[model samples]
Target chain A: MSADLLIELIGVGKSFPKVSRASDRLRALTSLLLGRSPGRVSNVLEGIDLTIHRGQSVGLIGENGAGKSTLLKVITGVYSASTGSVRRLGTIAPLLELGAGFHPEQSGRENLRTNALLLGMSPAELAASEADIIAFADIGDYIDEPVKHYSSGMVVRLGFAVIAALKPDLLITDEVLAVGDESFQKKCVRWMERYLADGGTLVLVSHSMYHIQKLCQHAIWLDRGRIRKQGDVFDVTQDYLAWHEKKSADTGIEHRLTANGEYAVLRFALNGDTGTLPIELPLGEDLLVDVELRGRDDRAPVFGIGFKRVDGTAVYGTGSEFERQPAKRLAHGHFAWRLRFPKPSLLPGTYVITAHALDPEGVRLFDDLPRTVIVRGRTPELGLVRLAHVWEDPT
Target chain B: MNLLISLLAHFVQREIRERFLGTVSGGAWLLIGPLLTLAAYLFVFAEVMKVRLHADAGDSFVVFLALGLWPWFAFSESILRGTTAIRQNAALIGKIALDRQLLVQAAVLSAFLIHGLGFVLVLIVLKLSGYALNLAGLPWVLLGLAGLALTAYGLALALAAAAVFLRDIESVLAQVLMLGMLLTPIFFPPSQIPARFAWFVSFNPLAVWIGCIRGGLLERGLPDASGLVLAGGVAIAALLIGRFVFRRAAPHFEDYL
Candidate 1:
């Protein structure tokens, strides 16, 4: 790690054991006695290596249960890793789990003292910053009222106001900005921007791609508690989204298992007559979809195929019934359902090809394939779904 | 020293505020506990059991018990509060960036301050009820507070550490306090006990400190020199042991909480 780096984590890993419902207390004790392990427990973070330079704003993006929050907490020392080391060069203000230190029964002023003290502010520091904290929280007479009486927004406002005033060397923020109203969210973002501009380091964990692109110069995508990709904000975010989209598509087909049973589309691909997978095509050329489906029963299924443009514009689809052809019987064996689209006029970008199978009674026998075809641009694109346009002007 | 004193000062003030705020009548009702306990003691011993001591030491036997009982109340409450001091504030201890040991000490200090104030009120009542104040025995009164403070401080740290791993310590300590009050020289002087069990009173730290206050404020003046010394020694030992436990438990606190 460079000397200028404000935070460094080397091979940092954390794991929590799965506590079975029947053996909760026993597992807790047994896990304690058995000691920590990499494989025996659920890894919330594994082999996390990152160096955050001073004044850098780093955004963390990942799917749900991707350990984004856990990584931030580890960086802030709210949680310690089971293995590896984290060396922090400056004071860290953990904005993770905001309003965590406030007492419910205590008045806002008293809670201010307690919270400030908890945050490592001295008595004098608290007293000096009291005016600014109160002004920012903006709960006039209610400052004397107990904190439990305050609304969720008021609590967040107070918490943010206190920390923003402190202006620590490093700020670790979780996805708590979503708690406040739109205006307050804007305020928080503005303050964060100012903090970064003033040479303060920030580690942010948010699910919002727009915020990550707008704020951070660098980003990390965590998947299954490990770094999947780390690079410039846009690149990592795009890759993460693409992977997320693929995962969702896989699950989308699986959800149809109630109707499809074990007979389902396993994979779908597109290729030319020579078996070359062309990403783009000449407007008059053919596009063939090779779909593989596995079946345990001889349902004598009739296949259906569709080629749709990226924007939900259906270019073409047909089944045996639609084509006025008799249905073919599918034996209890692996089979490929291939469909060709001739002179497909897909404009550019990506278009999806879906394949499914149905019985003669029109009931779905095997579900849809979980992949999309990319129809690249032969020329500079006008739109994703192309409609051949003819222009005639009379002057 | 300066930091310690300041931490203590703030803790004491906060404790006083919390106790008063927690009650319906605040400080006004603090007297109710001692007075009611005094009444019950007087009824049980003086009326129901018809027990009498040789010393005609006061206008009211109830006043004798109140003076001793109030201080012991402070000591016991301090120990009880100290037991959960760090555990109850697990959020503050685990998340906060302050000195971990100071948090436990603060709870001990708070309990001591409350009891100290209550101790003063009992003395004023004793003087008002015609018991003469021996100015010479004043050192022993201060010593009583010191003994209670040290013992409470030690127990606070130890219990704070133990409570992190074992939750049952809080309830166990409460039961210990109740049993301790009956065994100690709180309601009656240790001299009234039989010879064999007198050693039990001497062994119990609370008995030594509470007995010191009883002898100093009720008997005449100053506690026996050796007894006061033994009380101070036990208190010093408690403080040392408690400090060790607290420091050892500090690093694991974040994990457990």
Candidate 2:
């Protein structure tokens, strides 16, 4: 292995022995003693091939029970792989869970010493950083109390403080950021940013796409104990979110409607594509909606467009009638309108575009057509649309 | 190697502290408990039964029993605690990845360290009481105790690993150790047993260990070279078998635990 290669896994897999009954345990023990695989086993991960180089920040995104935690354990050597090989180099600090190595009966101070030593710090090294760790934790007087007496927030504070002081070559954290209060979470995020800037490697697992996009340069999506996709952070996370949107849309109520009555939509197209499939557009790109409606009695119908998130949250809506512009007359009973959003300021996610056709008065709804639009890009901003803003210098 | 040694030291310290954490008198009970047991044994055998040994003319029954009792406590207690070491720390084992053998070794080492200090205090008391002990044979007695400790550690390692798979080992071992103590001739000399059963004393490895220590302290002269050789062989064999079983079972402990 090269010195710069922090972790490497080739076709690695892990399985646990299934020993629900007393006889199964006996059989498993006997087989293990005799140098054989257990009689019955359940595989948690399969054919996982991953390589993480030094100074590389990677994010692991997956739903629950997708074997993300098991993969992390295998990388950290907590669980030996049942097949293939795993090789890791350098000092690794894994915050696998809350209070994992802590003794409930021991004081926080004592647990810190044990945990620091277990992370491969020498006695002298631990002594030097002891004060810095306590200060970072900032839990006065509670440090002397038993860990069982601490609140859950206090426990995570102490845990993160120890890891921060250690400054390991590689840091692996699993969903630990959600437990701390707002200030501490900010402190941890700032520390991690500095750590990464200083050439420290990181492998983070989180459900929040904002955090993943902010911290990681690469991402891997695991689905059903296998790597579904792995590549650039933007590409993989976008694909994962699109997959979730499609899944929920399948079980959601149908919105497609057949044309009926007067003022019905005769044809609709987004970006010149009239097909039923959703359209993918990059952020800050222009969106054009074209619709042709049928009007009775030769009166032009009003065309309106509405934008919403995949979860039915309205983002923006406007109609030609609101702007005092009438639809263009075409042939005998046909009317058409073209709506353009110049450089739409929408965040990266799936959104639905609904077109409405009304009578000339724009009071009664006549027809509705819905189409899906996926905005693709990577940004740490929250919410649906990016509001215009400017930050003035304090000086 | 340095890491392993440091980890072992930390675990041994924790094990000793855990033993007396909740007690009021704390460490004082270490010496006081053994002294009280000695007092009760003296009352029962020396006063009530009037037991005497034919092998030693000058030493009382209390002196003869004291020589063997403390070593037996160290040996038996080490096995008992070591057997439960893995099961007791299941929480730590399931979370952090470290050397599992250290847990068992720490338990055994702490037991011997505690009882060894008590054994030294007993020897000091015997010397101050005007007993004609062959103090020059102290090195041989120490060697005998070291051999017994090695044997106990070997058995502890094997039993501790097995106990992870078989919960019954802890309960069953208590009965077996009690029966073993009675069969080792700790209270009675080998000469008291019938001629037909004399072979039982000769075949018992613990009997050879107690005899070696008693010979050095009671002025029976240095232990015979053949008996020392026999004890050394058994200790080494037990250690090898214990290590073999422990290594095979260590990797699967997490699955079963």
Candidate 3:
């Protein structure tokens, strides 16, 4: 192992025996005693190959039941892998499930002492930092009171305070920031920023994309106990968010196909592609919508174009009637419209482009068609669309 | 190794504190409880039952019983507490990664420390009251107690691991310990048992330990070489086998727990 590499896991896998039944437990006990794999197991992680080097902050993002906690446990040595190997160097402080080892009957101070010792702090080191921990927690006299009387936030405060004092080589935290109050959250974030600035390695697991992108330079996305993506933080988080957007779009609302409407959309395409596949457009490029509409009578149909995120959030919408520009009449009762957006400043994400054919009065909706468009690029900017801005230096 | 020792000391302190927590008299109960049991047994055997030792015996019946009873309590109590140590700390086992054997060792150590202190106070009272005790044999008696503690620790390790998988071990262990106390020669002298059943006493390891201590303290003599060898063999064997079973079952304790 290189000295710079803090952790290395190659083909690591973990499985738990199905010991719900009495006979199964007995069988498992016998097999374990005989040094064999227990029969009938549920594999939680498989073929995980990863290496975390010194001074690298990596974020772990995954849905619920995606084995994020299990992988952390395996890395922290709380759970040994059922197969393959995991080699780790340097000290690690895992803030998994805050106050997990705290004895409720004991005082907060006493629990801190025990936890610090368990985290490999010597008695002298703990004694030296005891005051710092108490002050950092800032729970007042509650530190002397039994831990059972403490509120949940107080517990988290005490837990984080102890780890902060330890200053371990590698810090692995799992959603620890979601509990504390806003000011305390800011304090912890500031502390973590300083810790990272000091070249400490971190592995953070959180559902909040903002925190992941802020703290981590690299990210790994786990889906169903497997690594779906791993790369630069922006790219992985973008892919993760797009996947969630697509999932919600699949389940959120269904679009109605009005084939027999009076003013139906005969054809709707983005950049001359009339297929169901989503059009991949580069960021900052122009977007063109070609629509061919059919009307029942000799009335011109109004054309409306709109953009929405896959999650049904409207980004931009407009109608030709609002601008007093009518679509060119191709034939009797048939009209065609070509709308152009020159250099749209949309962010990289999945969006749905909808073309609507309304009555000439633009008050009654008649027919609408939706097409998917994916804006592909890499940037650290957030939100749906970018606004023109400039940063002025202090004079 | 230093960390292990430090952790063991912390756990032992915690175990001792937890044992006396919520009690009115707190730590005083450690000595008082055993002393009361001694008083009750003394009243029953020495007064009501009119029990007496052999005519040539140097010590009274109460002394003989006290010498045996205190050591037995230390050994049995340690084993009982050690057997349940893992289950009692299932919360910690599931959360943190530490040496699992430390829990069992701490449980046994705390039990012995408490009972050992009580035993020392009783011996002081007996000696101050002018009862005939071989003060020179006290070191041998201490050595005997240490041997019994090793055996208790070994059994506790194996039993504690097994109890995680088999809950019935806890209940069954209480019954077995009760039966074992009767079979051992704690209440009566070895000479009193019938000739046909003398082999049972010879094979019972606890009997050998109690007899060795009793002989050193009451008879003012060293333990026989054969009994010493047998006791030593049992203690070492129990330790090795117990450690083997414990290590094999420890990693999977989180799953079963």
Candidate 4:
């Protein structure tokens, strides 16, 4: 509870009952009556220990169902934690669900008065600031119209105008920038930048990595209701990208040998290792693909190797025909093909390398093996590949 | 306390204004509902059934009818609206965290104030009709109205909390309010009922508060001190219980919502 720290959560956890079926819900109610926990309690967040200080901006990045919204609700006092304690200092303006506080029956101008008062603004203070909020909102005649008649974008404009004007000590928002047009988003981003410059603390949750890296000083990567990794925005997002890259490549992927088939992929290796599939290779370094296959008849079976990004985005694909080389036979019904890149100028990301054994004609694929490889590099750049360039000085 | 009052005042103004928005007459529309009901009842009971207030008011049934009816309508309408105030403001509740009980109080107090206007007009009409109008009992009648409002607000707090958990309370309250209107001595005086049912009017808080209003303004000046004491006791007790239940149920509001 230091004066410098604005918010702190120690071992905070939240659980929601998983009641899909009516019987399950009924059981949950009965269990409550019986003074016992209901069936199938799923954790949305658990053992979460986080501290946010004044003037610090933190981003929460996670896939859907990763408990990002739930944690925000917990921090904002909307939902009580099921376990542990949370201590928050200073007033919090939680823009968790936009326009949730505005009365639909009231005019946009009238709603401003009520919502501002709810935020602890006095009548005299609200009167003084009303002109600024109305100008920022920029809905000229619609301010007199009831809120229910407002379009969605207009509502966001008004809500954002209120939040921007109040500028409370702690601002907690979820995907507010995702709404509205590009110019409005830009305006919000500029306001947020100024807000941070004025020593306001912010907790932002968004899916856009570009925005996260641009706005946040620190980030927490939440995966399956827990903090998987937390630190600098770029570092945590990189690790999170790699983890999902590996996971998606592994999900529902099975290695199967053809039943009673003549041709089979015996061993596929990346960088001289056959046991483990992943072999970390630096960007622009040589990647060696070694394949050992057993063919019933050796008429120079075709060998193919391809590289694809972890999310199944194809990077490069080539085979023996493309390389103008067929598989060289070593013994009866057994062949070994080796493809080496002296220096592969590929992108820095998670890539899946594939080894395929095809007929000599290469029209139909016979057998293939997939392996995930991490192409690690150090650069503050975006997109698939890094190209070498020189900056020209303009005189 | 002052902040709560200011907040509640703002909310009350919003509630009253928004209820009659886009109308030509503006705030005068707030009087329409209560006045219409009074006119309908005065025609039914006074002209048709030949009833009068205490048999001495002399053809001034409208004033006596209004004095008994308006405050009761205020209490009934306030309690009904207050029961659903929190649920109706779910948008505000879910977004901004504030003292949610203010929603209930604002709903109750606003309805009482607006309907109190119609009751004042009825008193003026009675004074013009040569009935003995004791201007000194004005504060006492206001106190009686305050007691009725407190009693209604306390009930509203409890009902709002219960309605959030069991939505059936809303419809159940509607049915009970229908019974309460018939059971209350609005159309007739308490002396008409049998002796066995004397406790029914004696124990009823609205009955005694209505009596104080009629006595202070129409018949007996200053009202019965015992009835005022009873009204105060009911207000305090209901308020304490209402606070107890509302505080206990406030945290669970998000769960059901």
Per TM-score, the best of the predicted structures is 3
Q: What is the C-alpha RMSD of each candidate to the true structure, in Å?
A: 8.3, 3.1, 2.5, 4.2
Order of quality (TM-score): 3, 2, 4, 1
Q: Which ten residues in a row have the lowest lDDT in candidate 4 chain B?
A: B52-61
Estimate the overall C-alpha local distance difference test score of candidate 1.
Answer: 0.70
- Residue-by-residue lDDT tens digits, candidate 1, A279-369: 5454456777666555556543556777665445577777755775543334454555656667677653445566776654557555775
Instruction: Give lDDT tens digits, candidate 2, residues B1-257.
Output: 77778778877887887677668989788778778988998898778887778656667777788888888888899999999999988888777767888888999999989888888888777778877678887876788788888999899988988898888899999899989888877776666777888877777778778877787888673446776787789899989978987888886777788
The worst-scoring run of ten residues by lDDT in candidate 3 chain A lies at A252-261
On DockQ, the leading prediction is 3
> In model 2 chain B, where is the ten-residue run with the lowest total lDDT?
B219-228
Q: Residue A113 deviation, candidate 4, in Å?
A: 2.2
What is the per-residue lDDT of model 2 for residues A1-395, given as tens digits with 9 covering 90 to 100?
37699999999888888888887867776776787887888988999999999998999998889999889888887677888899988888897685677888778988887888777887788889999999999999999888889999999899889999989888998678777899999998889889999999999999988778888999999998889999999889988987887777778885655556788988889988888889998988898888989988988888888898887778999988899887788888898888788889998889888888888888888888888899998777887899999999989
lDDT of 2 at B65: 83
The regions of model 3 sitting more than 4 angstroms off are A297-300, A329-334, A361-366, A388-395, B48-51, B220-223
Clashes of each: 1, 0, 0, 0
User: Local distance difference test, per candidate?
Assistant: 0.70, 0.84, 0.87, 0.79
After superposition, the stretches of candidate 1 with alpha carbons farther than 4 Å from their true spots are A1-3, A15-43, A254-395, B1-12, B22-24, B31-40, B55-63, B90-103, B215-233, B247-257
Per-residue CA lDDT of model 3 for B179-218, tens digit only, reads 8888987777777778899988887788878876887787
Off by over 4 Å in 2: A135-145, A175-190, A253-266, A292-304, A319-336, A356-369, A393-395, B44-52, B55-57, B194-197, B219-234
Taking chain A of model 2 alone, its TM-score versus the true chain A equals 0.90
lDDT of 3 by residue, A1-395 (tens): 37799989999888877877777877887787888877888988988989999999999999999999989988988888889899989888998788888999888998898888888888889889999999999999999898999999999999999999999899999777778899889988889889999999999999988788888999999888888999998789988988989998899887765756688888998888999888888898998888998887868888888899999999999988888887789999999888889989899899999988888777778888899898878776788999999999979
